[model samples]
Target: MRGRQLRRAEICLLVTVAAVPVAACGSERETVERPTVPRGMDRQADSDADRLAAEKAALDAYAGYLAASRAASGRSDPHAPELSRFLADPLLTRVQMSILQAKEHGAMRTGTLKSDPTVTSVSLDSKPATVEIQDCLDATGYRLVYAKDRRVVPGSGGGRHLATATATRYPDGRWLISSGAAHQDQPC
Candidate 1:
């Protein structure tokens, strides 16, 4: 009995010692604020808090993407470099292509684009983890117009509509808008 007890104690000590370095080396996303959680519940608190942070960051990235797109569209700039800051490859390519088409048609987007976005789902366990967002997009104060004369383009729309997006976490720890869609048919 004494020998078994000593072996268990040694194992526990080894585990505690091994855990210290691993804890210290946790990834940035795992770094949560020191919460007021009770001693044993710290892990739960940390996970919940980290999830909330990821949600907020994803929404922020969505806003950044919109703001950057608007800024570029207002100038009819197809090659607007700012879009890269908030967007990743395939979507980036598609968005730039859309802007190029708009510029080619001599049109520009102008005015305000307001959005109320919520995190619809979070998949932290997925490879490259992602957060899904649903937004009630209010573009009533915004418009697409002919650049040369500043006249509203026919069929250019503004209203409350549904929009959805997926925000993916990059290896570098930045959340970026990876995919999205605006639902013109579904009024919000």
Candidate 2:
């Protein structure tokens, strides 16, 4: 019985020793490194990443514009300096004019103006990249308030507006809205 027990212990020790080489071989196979990207492919990947980053920046700028517009509705001055950071040229002028008109009529909006913008397309091949965005405006919670008595304006029910805007990226990597048009009573 003692000899048999000794033999079994010896067999177990041998088995463990034999398993070490098989485990080491498996780890060696796993340690093999993956192939590196080719030089041309690497450059292409960089370009793609840059393009995607620019697109995201443009979208962010558009969102900023929407926020500015919402805030402008509550202010007497529609051409707030903050709005200029996101808008440029003809579009800026148009928005400013509209805000001025509303102010002149003693109209101000209260509550939130929600906007959801979607980037339909982006073209970054040119110096000034162009981006097209579709925005869904929800003014359902917004209320038009009169400046004189702070009374809610009549027929001021909030509605949905669908708008398409075009933005241009400047040399300084800033994106600004160039033009935009909206249709009232449209489904978001």
Candidate 3:
């Protein structure tokens, strides 16, 4: 049960190694604005306090997702505990797979991922409430590196890019990041 956690500590010089993809990591994203109650969301239907609470909870979920992803990638551990706490299927499986691949290749992503995230919209009236967030992830500080030697992998430094995610409130009253995407090619 304890075989797969990758240590971020620098490795001995003699170990063989490879690089992980920088695209697999993101973190330290700050919320830029209070979520707007826009179309698909009824301001009259839900009280301001309720709407604000939902939005805040959703953003909190988004933050958790980023933090969890960052930790998992840094450790190259797909089964990181926080991943399950903040994310659901599809996205959950995707992130785990990314980290697993990095682990298999003897690499991991390490360093801070600076970002500015904003809640674009929220839909509390929808069956299971949801919030959409957009972000400019400045991953310039994040890098993919060989687990051994802690050397930065060539061509693996990151840059600011547009990213998006959907936070869904479940029947259990937990808000989770259900899905997300980073448009690596689209600089923000």
Please provide, for model 1 over 89-160, each residue's C-alpha lDDT reduced to its tens digit, 9 standing for 90 to 100. 778888898888989999989999999999999999899999999999999989998999989999997999
Candidate 3 residues lying further than 4 Å off, grouped into runs, are: 1-46
| TM accuracy, model 2 | 0.73
lDDT per residue as tens, model 3, 1-188: 23333333334222323222222332213222343457656655457778788889988998899999999999888999999999998899999999998889889999999878898998988988999999999999999999999999888889999999999999999999999999998998
Write model 2 residue lDDT over 15-132, tens digit each, in one string: 9998788678656454455346677997898888977886787788888887787688788678689889999988899988877887999998778878888889878887678988
Per-candidate TM-score against the hidden true structure: 0.78, 0.73, 0.74
Residue 181 displacement (Å), model 2: 1.7
Instruction: Name every residue pair that clashes in candidate 2.
Output: none
Model number with the top TM-score:
1
lDDT of 2: 0.83
Which whole-number lDDT from 0 to 100 does residue 187 have in model 2? 71
Model 2 alpha-carbon drift over 4 Å, by segment: 1-35
Highest lDDT scorer: 1
For model 2, the run of ten residues with the poorest summed lDDT: 28-37
